[model samples]
Target: MANVAAILGDVVEGDRIFSPTSLHLPEFLPAEAVVYPTTEAELAAVMACAHQHRWRVVPTGSGSKLAWGGIGAGVDLIVSTARLNQVIDHAVGDMTLTAQAGAKLADLAPLLAQHNQFLAVDPAYPDRATLGGIVATADTGSLRQRYGGLRDMLIGISFVRYDGQVAKAGGRVVKNVAGYDLMKLLTGSYGTLGVIAQLTFRLYPRQEASKTVVATGTADAVAALAGELRRSPLTPVSFDLLSPALANALGYGEQFAVLARFQSIAAGVDEQVQALSALVGASLTHQILGDDEDENIWAAAGKALFPQPEAAGQTVLAKVGLPSDRAIAWLAQLPSGSLARIHASSGLGTVRWAATTAEDVEKLRFTVADLSRAGVEGTSGYLTLLEAPLSLKQSVDVWGYGGNALSVMKALKAQFDPGNSLSPGRFVGGL
Candidate 1:
């Protein structure tokens, strides 16, 4: 550690480098040091040093979603993008913004709001979540139903390879080169491909008005309404099916409810709200939410999506993916007390429940396995435990299945990080 610090002179701080004990990093992966870089050049220098030493490096941003992905096998250095945070450009006319990778969405959001534009992706922990972390994790929230996720919003990226080569793909403009497609390759790679330095994303104009319509019914009925909304002309920015537990948590009287968010001109929003209410009709009671009420409900739902317990072992969270049409059926398969918030249109869902006993861990393992088997047998689904007790993590494969893409993923990893210096084993198929 001292040798690398000395090599970088005063640029690297010895105090910041330490073992990975603070963040929710894999307990099994022992990190020798954590280096903080304020600039891309410094990041490249550190990575080059690590590569020369053959030390495995794990690039991180805020450590918010560090525990995601497979278990890291030999992580020696933690390269953090803490101080490299800045809004490099905001071409409002072009509806695009470029920011340093470490810039938190929380900070960037307010700036964009000033210009009547905003990034569409909405992940949890916005206050602490950095742009690089969000992109690396490919995290998205309910807003994805309307604007799509990070993959769609991102237009350009700059990254430092394991060998310290700085590379970029795409550009500030919407149109770009055709080959490589590095933007898509690195977006959700969990930082295994390269250390993301800067990102350029297309922005959306803030809607003139917004409203959320809430409706309650049985799972089948809620699914039917969700299906109807998809087929109808009503354009909701977010269409979510809330679990009974989650619905109750959000202060809804019913156990199951559908929350639809509309954003457009005031008149259009009003029309969509009325049409949505009529679609539910007598089958379910509906309510058009005031701005305050709408914010409160969506805020609660976001918290539920990434629940943080007051104490350890209080909750276990997992992400599930299924066919949009089979979401209800899949929800029915979960054990009672399990709570979920699902994107009705995307078929992506997140499940959470209290972790009270060893039995619960076993049940979770079984559930993940069952979902994996279903995907294999043509049901087309997947389940991944995102947060859990260390004991529970050790007991099962958090990533249920890798599928046939495992080989190709492995080949890509070998080509990009043959030295295994970039987030080793912290990827699909343990790449």
Candidate 2:
């Protein structure tokens, strides 16, 4: 601790690091100290010293999503990038931007808005979500239907390895390289492999006009409408199927609903809306929201999906991936009162439920597995517990491990963090 403090000279105590909502309690994972490094060089030096001492270190960026993954064991130091928040560059003409890992999306959004451009991500806790934190979690929102996830937006990354060595991957422009795809490798690694210092992303110009078309019907009917929208010529920025509870929470009537967003020139958006309405006909109750109404609806929708200052019982946030054709069937299997927010275009969704006892959590876990396997298409599905109580997390693997890539992930972790000093036991298969 003395050696690291001497090198970094910005040491802080680790008290008050954990929030009440934190999945992992600070009392369980006692840290020797917390250090903040402003510059990449200082960060590397601190990491190298920790590596030399063989001390476990956990990296943090804004601490927005710190309660995301399994709590890493034996952590001795908490290296924070809070002071590393800076917008390094914004090549507006090139439609690319670069910023330090700790740079908050809230701060960067306005800066990019000046140029009529923005990064295409709408992670929960956006006001505090850092660039590195979003990449580490690979978090996304409704924008995913149009711009894709973090892996798609990321173009370059600069990170410091466990041994204090700096590594680079990709470049400013989108071009293929000869070696490993570090951009994809570390995007959702949960800071187990390396500590991201800076990142570059492809930016998109903000749309001129946006509107949402929402329609309600039975679960099966909504599912069919989702398929129709996917097959139709109309282009939507986001297509989501909301559960009745979630729909009501988002300002819609308490009924199954299909919500789609269209953004473009006024005429283009209007055309798409009319075509969509005609396709659905009078079979379902439908409405078109103008600019102000659209914004309000989407804001309420965001709250429904990721309620601000989440209520005490809303402890679980799980991401499920499966074919859209099976979404309705799969959703029917969930326990009553579970709120689901699903992406209709992509077969991805999030389910939030409250469980009182550990046994109840275990039961829900099995339900997820059974429903995923029950797919009629004979295709596999995935359920990852993005957030949960520490007790619930201890009983089952948060990330169900069935893929063949576990060995490769182990190899990469061993190679990147030979001393097992970086975020030990917080990744897939406890890599």
Candidate 3:
């Protein structure tokens, strides 16, 4: 501890460094000290010191997702980008924005709104989730149905490597793509590759109007509507399949439901809403929400599935990926108390619940295994445990991936951090 403080003392202020005991961190990560670096250079210096001493480091931003992924063996130092929050540039004309890793999404929203532009990804906890953390976790919400994931919006990235060397990839402009696609590589590396320092993301013009059409009915009826909407020409920003519990929580009755949100010119949005309502017909009860009602519904749905600051250790959260056609069936198979919100087109979303016993974990694991066997041909279905009690995490593999990419991922991890000095054993296959 003394050695770490002495080495990094000159890089950052003494008040910016503290003992790990002062913060609420996961028990699996036994970090000696936590340091907040205000600039990319200061962060690079800290990484260099840790590399020289072969000290394992865990990179974080606000520590919101520190408990995600696998439990690490241990960490000697924790480096945070909390103080590195800053908007580097906002090229309004170019439709791109560059910012520091610690800049919260919530803070960027209003700024972009002022220019009638916004980042297209809808990640969890915008109030506290930073650009780096959102990219690291790949937590893009249902907006992915239209705008794609964070990797798609991200045009460039800068990070401090394990050896304390700063590295960059891509360019600020959306058209620049001359180098290795490290932007995508580092997007979901879980900080096992490097510490994200800054990012540049492509932005979209804010729509003039927005509306959501929510339809509630039996699983078959909702699935029919979802299929019809996908085949239609209507473009929705969000198309999510709500599980029974999630639907009930959203005041939509305890049944399967699908929520489709459209954003465009006022006339366009109104036409699409009416078209969707016509498709709903008499098969299912439906409602069209506009203005504040539309925004509130989406916010409530996001909060229900995403991990919150208050539900840290007491709840279990998992990311589910399956065949889009089988999403309704998959939701139907989930445990009774579980709440889920999955993207209807991409078949990716979150499932969460308050788990109390070992039996509950086993049952969920069995359910996942059964579903995996029934997935589409040549595609692997997976359920990654994102957040849960330490005991449950220890008992089950957090990443239940049984694909053939383990060897390749291991090689990449070895090449990135040879000494295993960055967030060790916290990624897939213990990469």
Candidate 4:
């Protein structure tokens, strides 16, 4: 038998010191590693031991989003994905690819390139983020403008539940909505539900033609142009609004930018470009560019959002979802003294905001109440902290109280992971 103590060296010190997988990840510390298994069988065995000993487990990929949720209340063991890296299958005819949980996205990109296909949802740090981590965090990223998100790409999953069950859901094909949409259910469950072992995602054909439109304006002007383009029939693949502060972070300095991407057949791409150029004419500074340009610009834009924890500050990064029109109103509601930005994906209905404050719990509660009073119902407009104080973990509700869905979630969790051994107290409705 392998000694647990001997298995992990320097990962734990005197049973106290620990390491988070993301460099300078925020609001999380001393997250010790327990075991990293290469296959589902090994992962299942680890889960059994954890269930038996009642050890709390937290699964991680590249650790890109370690601070997005509150620190786990009892993280006794961390299941890192460093060992389980592989692209198990890439079925072009099937328009899907099955990958090991630990496979770095960068590694898979080239393989997909050979088949003239790509994962639609591209997070900022694709080269580093593991496939399983992307599914766990639901890291949609900027490409979501055209392809939607992980919630859309992920059609199947394989995971080790807390009860030692190696579970699988969905399949390699697109038509199976068969039983429960457990695949979608687990996308953003924050690992509180299970440790994902493998993933199968829908793929998109590589675009034959692609271009980016960069419109420059002040915060208000950029928001206006973003609004106009959103209403127009010309469909851009991605839309990004960089707040002045965030623009500074991206080094554009004084030039808050609006980015719209369009790609398709060469003729269709040209038509969209002509229509878009007409919209931003004279009213803004515009740049017409190609795919290489799109990659360079977005790489700069998206990378700016994933800075290290210290750079993110002791502030809270919150994701706000509201109707697209009311989306701009948030710039006024947030603390004037704070650093904040907005990126609206596919109109204003699904928007993400990032901000920093000294006291996130109080600030977040106030924002929730403010949006709720304004009738941000159904959603009640909750914000998950991007980075926060550990003390805030006990005080702030990362995902606030839900209504009926919360009950269903609890039951589902109970059915799958009765012990709450995975990501204790770190997910929505305290799952």
TM-score of each: 0.92, 0.91, 0.96, 0.86
Clashing pairs counted in every model: 1, 0, 0, 4
User: For all the candidates, what are their Cα RMSDs to the real structure?
Assistant: 2.7, 3.2, 1.6, 4.3
Pairs that collide in candidate 1 are 244-255
Please report, in order, the local distance difference test score of every candidate based on alpha carbons: 0.80, 0.78, 0.87, 0.69
Using lDDT as the yardstick, the better of models 1 and 4 is 1
Better of 2 and 4 by lDDT: 2
What's model 3's overall lDDT? 0.87
Candidate 4 is scored at a TM of: 0.86
Q: Between candidates 1 and 3, which one is better according to TM-score?
A: 3
lDDT of 4 by residue, 1-431 (tens): 13343444323333321344433444354545446666677777777777777777788776767666766676767776667898888889999999888898888888899989998876646667888888887778767777887888888888888866888888989877866788888898888888898999999999899888877766567767777887888877877665555555545565566767888999999999889888884657878878677678777665555555456554555555544544455544544433344556432222233333336445654565566557445555555554556765656666555446878888988877787778887777667
Q: Tens-digit lDDT track for model 2 on 301-401?
A: 66665654445354687787777766776666666767887787677888887765667655655655566667544445677776777777787777865
Cα lDDT of model 3 by residue, 57-120, tens digit = 9999888788889998789899989888999999999999999999999989999999999988
Q: Which candidate is the best by TM-score?
A: 3
Candidate 1 per-residue lDDT, tens place, 1-431, comes to 55544554554565545546545565756676677778788888888888878888888888877766666687777888978898999999999999999999989988999999999987967778899999998887889999998989898999999999999888898776655789889978988999999999999999998999999878878878888998998889998888877787778764678999999999999999988888895767778996788778888787766754443245778787776666666666666767788898888878887765656655655654556455456553667767776676666676776467888888888888888789887777666
Tell me the deviation in Å of residue 325 in model 3. Answer: 0.8
RMSD of 3: 1.6
Model 2 residue 68 lDDT score: 69
> Which candidate has the top score in lDDT?
3
